[model samples]
Target: MIKDHRPYVVKRAWLKFQKFYARHFLRPQLTRLGTGFTFMRPWHVELFGAPIRIGRYATVIATPDKKIRLSVWPAQAGKGHITLGDYCLICPGVRISSAEGITIADNCMIANGAYITDSDWHGIYDRLSFGQAEAVEIGKNVWIGDSAIVCKGVTIGENSIIGAGAIVVESVPANCVAAGNPARVVKRLDPEETFTTRAQFFADPAKLARDFMAWEQAVLQGNTYFGWLRHLLFPAKGD
Candidate 1:
């Protein structure tokens, strides 16, 4: 109950199935998707409208309780583009709803329950009308913390960190840490220090895959198929 009851082979099979589901069902919905991407529980990820583009080596994790939704509802025929660059991490409950455009650069990580929007779907006075829509730009290696809301016309600079649960309405400068309801600049990141991005982490994809499988094998050393079934049937306290 403290550990994964499924055997290593079962884990591998589950991963393979997830990948298969992504390729077969999830890929067709995307406007563009590059190779070597992992979408865990791909079915839980909802994609609507286009042009929704996601680049290579992206790791998107979605759960039943926390579904990742990318919805692009263009006001006009030529608008609404949602672009996520290479080596990005999209966690559970991340909803990106774009009426114009939302551009997220490479190596960026969007934490769980984060919401990025480009349009106020409802007007202030006229609740039925869709209000102004502006493009949102997120620079390279930017980290959007859990439950953060990035509103319209916001441009977050490179290597900046948006604090957890912050509501961003204005542009965030590079190499800084922003927090609070309006999300002010609380601290600035060290320009001298090198940032280790997702691009760097996935530099050697083959090696990383090998190491990951090796880790799974080691961690699920004594797990069995029967044990997994037992746990599913009657889960214990730790489980």
Candidate 2:
């Protein structure tokens, strides 16, 4: 029995096209975007308010229904700012809004439905009055779980893990796991323990990308343009 490799080739071609579109169209809109930024569905990622900077090899995944929003609101004293460090991964339904500032350090992985805000948006008593704005800092190698909320004036230390559905209202110490309504330290990670992050994958992204393409070509060696067309029109049973 012959293996059908057309679907893989078609998928690879589509992804390459998306990457090209993202680089040419989306990169220009950003205040500062570093090299090798990959956007999985760039149309669903929204950015507003300037002075936002994202570092090299960052990957952002978004869908039409679960858009990833990064916004900064202007303040009377100082303007809002957002800085995302190298090799960060931001998943779908993640929103980062800043009135003062928000800084996410290198190799941070923000899970789906996470929210990071630096302002309350409005005062409790004074409906018209804007609430206090503060800086929110997320340290290097932090993992923010799904549906977590990191509120104003919060600082999550390096190597800390914010559990799923946690609401972080206070500072979290380094190398610890936090969870619950108001996130607190649940467990501590060993100081000497070493773990891999998204940074490792991006260290030599170009070479890895080339190798991937080469492998794909080898796998789809006998696949023709006609096969790709057929795959597009009438996808396989499992597809």
Candidate 3:
């Protein structure tokens, strides 16, 4: 069977176009956009207010309905800041709102529908008045699961994992896994085991990306245009 290289070529060109769009249109808007920052759907990333900085090699996967929102509210006492560190992966429906400050360190992976807020937004009784706002710090190499909420005055330590649907209200220790309504330390990670983070993927991104493309092309070698269309419309079994 004759191999078709058209799909591979088209995909490469589309990726180049997306990168161009992100650099020219989106990068200028942010307070600080570091080098090699990529977004799958850049249009879905909504940035409001100033002092929102994202570090190098960060990837954000956002959609229209599940937009990734990063906002910093101005304060009378001190300025609000939201800083995302290097090689972090932020999924769709991740809303990070800072009234005082919110800092997420390097190599962190935040799953979809996760909310990280530094303030209550409104007072308990006063309603109109703004509630207490404190700095929420998420340390390096943390993995926040789906639908988790990191509330005010919380510090999640390094190499920790927040389980799905967890609501973190207090400080989580390093190398531990936390879960539940008021996220508690359920298990501790083995300190002896060596783990790799997303940062390693971006270390040689160009070579890795080319390798991935080659693998994809090999997989779709005998696939026709019609076959591709059919796969999109009605996905194959076990796909």
What order do candidates take by TM-score, descending? 1, 2, 3
Q: Look at candidate 1 and tell me the lDDT of residue 2.
A: 72
Cα lDDT of model 3 by residue, 1-239, tens digit: 23333466666677788788788877887788888887887878888887889999999999989999988885545668899999999999999998899999999999999999999989999888778888899999999999999999999999999999999999999999999998999999996888798888888989977898899788667766676666667675654
Least well predicted 10-residue stretch by lDDT in candidate 1: 1-10
lDDT of 2 at 200: 83
lDDT of 2 by residue, 48-147 (tens): 8877889998989999999999998856556689999999999999999988999999999999999999999898998776688889999999999999
Ranking of candidates on lDDT, top first: 1, 2, 3
Q: Which candidate number maximizes lDDT?
A: 1
Q: lDDT of candidate 2?
A: 0.89
For candidate 1, write residues 104-126 as lDDT tens digits: 99999999999999999988998
Instruction: Name the runs in model 3 displaced over 4 angstroms.
Output: 1-6, 222-239
Selected candidate, larger lDDT, 2 vs 3: 2
Per-candidate clashes, comma-separated: 0, 0, 0
* Candidate no. 3 TM-score: 0.88
